[model samples]
Target chain A: MTNENAITVKNLTKTFGDFTAVDAISFEVGKGEVFGFLGANGAGKTTAMKMLIGISKPTKGEANVAGFDVRTQAEDIKKSIGYMSQRFSLYNDLTIKENIVFFGGIYGLKKSVIKAKSKNLIDELGLHDEADKLVGSLPLGWKQKVSFSVALLHDPKIIFLDEPTGGVDPITRRQFWEMIYREANNGKTIFVTTHYMDEAEYCDRVSIMVAGKIEALDTPKNLKEKYKVDSMNKVFLKLARNIE
Target chain B: MSISIKNISKSYGKVKALTDISFDIKQGELFGLIGPDGAGKTTLFRILTTLLFPDKGEATVADYDIIKDYKDIRSHAGYMPGRFSLYQDLTVAENLTFFATIFGTTIEENYDLIKDIYMQIEPFKNRRAGKLSGGMKQKLALSCALIHKPKVLFLDEPTTGVDPVSRKEFWEMLKRLQKKDITILVSTPYMDEAELCDRIALITDGEILQVDTPQAIMQAFPKTIYKVRTSETYRLIKDLKTYPKTHSAYPFGEYLHFTSTDENLDPEELIHFLEQKKHTQIEVEKIDASIEDTFMELTHTREVNAHD
Candidate 1:
């Protein structure tokens, strides 16, 4: 069932002992939309993301990701979504081809499909020459691109990118965004997070979390207008001004 | 000069980390080494901080030779590495005290020096360093680095991955530190932060690309950039790249920054071409080059030069 909303959350929350990491929050992400999830560090964005991605249990509330309940169908949710983070994505010691095959197998793809997808990915990324080279030897930008491709190996309908282009060069950052746009155009719902406010403006909608609560949620244009700021950076600064 | 480097180079086996790096920081000047990951910023910082040695050439920090007087530099310089190096199990106040004792000084001795920054996190002084938020951790790290009141401060990517609000505050603290006659050498990946420094050196791929004030560097961009926007962003980038006269096209927030190979480029002609391609809501405006634009251009030129 391909519902209009790829993700629906109502009062989703997570707590640790006496500390409420993610307070009661609610939101929905539509299909084929780019949703920017932004917040200050330790603002509970990570805690909330963990619950939605099917790794951690929520302390309270309800969320459905890709038509699967987060609490009951976490395995199905994991199968329906692709995730790529800058810190942990691919094995550096493995060759590019090997990493591709390994990830494809993890995603339960067949051997023949893994072989064919690996070829197409290498050719598309122009990494044919480096396919046999250790992933650790590749440049940071190239590695990031390769990691993102591997995340999409199983062709998930929704993708989650956690700072995929962090600390990358300017040109490479733009190139990564271009890849994001191509995927979104292909009808994949993109849920991404980034410290770079420029990337925020590219999303169809954005939600800013502050102190374990969603402080603002709207399109970038509307958020800018509401905050009376010319840029998302200014809006963020304005909202996070009172943070401890 | 607070810090002087002459043709310093370093290689990690086959990989060259720094090549012919030369720069000098004035006393009390806030100097920035701006670059992305894999740049030689950290390598140079390590050399200056006396944590690592350069294979060729020499450097001096606070009038002490990096090689001959490495021990003296250790006491005279305060370095905050990119990675958080403080003991996570220790409380915020304990970490500060620990660093102060190591430097043969006390936090009470330099209370006036770090009052502004230290006070911001003093409320959580009893919290474990591991339990602090990202911003709080950074403040504790900085306070510990400054507990000795060293003559020179070297911060490597201090604001990397920090939110905009905290990053701005951190730079403001740096501006105040510069006024206290403490020479500040900071490195960052954010190009916008480069403008906050009195002078900046743009390094990439282990080589310095340009060294100048942010204003001067932007002035020498050598291209007329136009902010172009339309409905289909992805298509616009592809079509613009395929254009014969296009020099560069990259995303700049809500617009695609376009530059032409020819000096006398006409925006009207570009608009007409996009209209033919069925792009609606077309807007094209001439804009000044930003530090990011200049960086990409310089890196691209370096690649082209390498090809030759």
Candidate 2:
């Protein structure tokens, strides 16, 4: 049955040699949902995300993202999803417009479509003044916004952001989240991982991973209430401590 | 020991790393250097700790010039770099001992200062420094930094990669260390952490943006702020920004922190405007400005003023 859920996993597990990076986790993300995947450093959030994006194979269990089986339809899954990593993945030496065109070319978009979309994105993000500037010359916040817009160049069904706002200022982070919310409103699912607990509150639902396991998964309000905490930061602390 | 920085400036080729930055850190004060990455926080820390010399300006630690008294400065201060620089292959105990020996002091002499932080990770003292968890590694690094009982401690983003709980625990440790009357200078990117500092200097792009107590900074916010939560938060932000009376509308927590160009704009009028814009379940009330809000306002104001 094709439900509203964009992603579905059952007993998903990922192991590297003897180490189980993601241990039998299961979750579902609704269409157009902003799902926050949160955990401390070295937790299984990235591993699970890699499995969902079909980059890493799951040792056991079944998983489907964007309605395709992760193992058998890995290529199809890749085409249907966009990913922005914590590390800036764009070429630093290239100009802003050049980078977007290059990514569009890789995705096999028509030159006209690339041009039109690039203009729209540049206008939307107010990057017109810096369009010809080298990506390396731009500030961290602008580069991140460009990276995110580049990720969505192909109009994928879902976007996976791994710690997208790692080092940006609060104002920039707010602006970034605004862009994410805009994408979600356009019926694109956003699955993101973040170390910033405050950012997790912006998600429709969030999953807290600890020790390769999903310790908590729910709306921010529900999780906060369940943990008897005032903020998502406090809730995460309680859960992380308990896991340890 | 007190710290004084005068007209400090550094550049890498054409890019100015720090620009005429000047600040004085009182003795035994838990002074915080708050800024984003590439804000010259690390450069300032390195210059203070005598690792790097500034092309311009002078600094003194405990009454000794940073350049002429490099040895004394190095011996009198402990520095925990942003990145874990301890020997990865060495065990926690070995690393601690190594740092202690480098300073010509044994752990026994400074054991009382680091007893609290060191005790937490003592059980895993045999584990390699690289093998420890982020929190554990932080504690071990901190303990090693304190192993020599330096007069002043310099920690550069010590809680960057650690968890929230660990960050809180680390701050508590600093508080305890403060009681011993050892001056501490910590730099952090997290705005929330600034409130924990006795006094904070907000740095950006190698410029000292503002330096004050957290409360003083918050009080200096030049606008009347309100928290607005609505069912249509995304649209509400857009709509509020378009409002003629609105000065700024930014997201904070679950609500949007908004300020108006007109101070006389009342809550009822805001609710009416939002309702007119089809926003449901609207909640609007005047609220206290936070350090993040204050910093954003200051920085944005600076940008605007510069443009003018």
Best by lDDT: 1
Residue A8, candidate 2: C-alpha displacement in angstroms: 0.6
Candidate 2 lDDT, tens digit per residue, B73-135? Answer: 888888999988889999999999999998889999989998998999999999999999888
Question: What tens-digit string does per-residue lDDT give for candidate 1 at A14-60?
Answer: 98999999999999999999999999888888889999999999989
A158: Cα error in model 2, Å: 1.0
List the candidate 2 regions with Cα displacement exceeding 4 Å: A1-3, A16-19
- The CAPRI-style docking tier of model 2 reads medium
Q: Considering every candidate listed, which one attains the maximal TM-score?
A: 1
In candidate 2, residue B166 scores what lDDT? 75
User: What is the C-alpha DockQ of each candidate?
Assistant: 0.82, 0.62
| Model 1 ranges off by over 4 Å | A1-3, A242-244
Error of 2 at B290 (Å): 0.6
Cα interface RMSD of each candidate: 0.9, 1.5
What are the per-residue Cα lDDT tens digits for candidate 1 across B180-265?
99999999989889999999999998899988999999999899999999988888998998788998999988899998999897
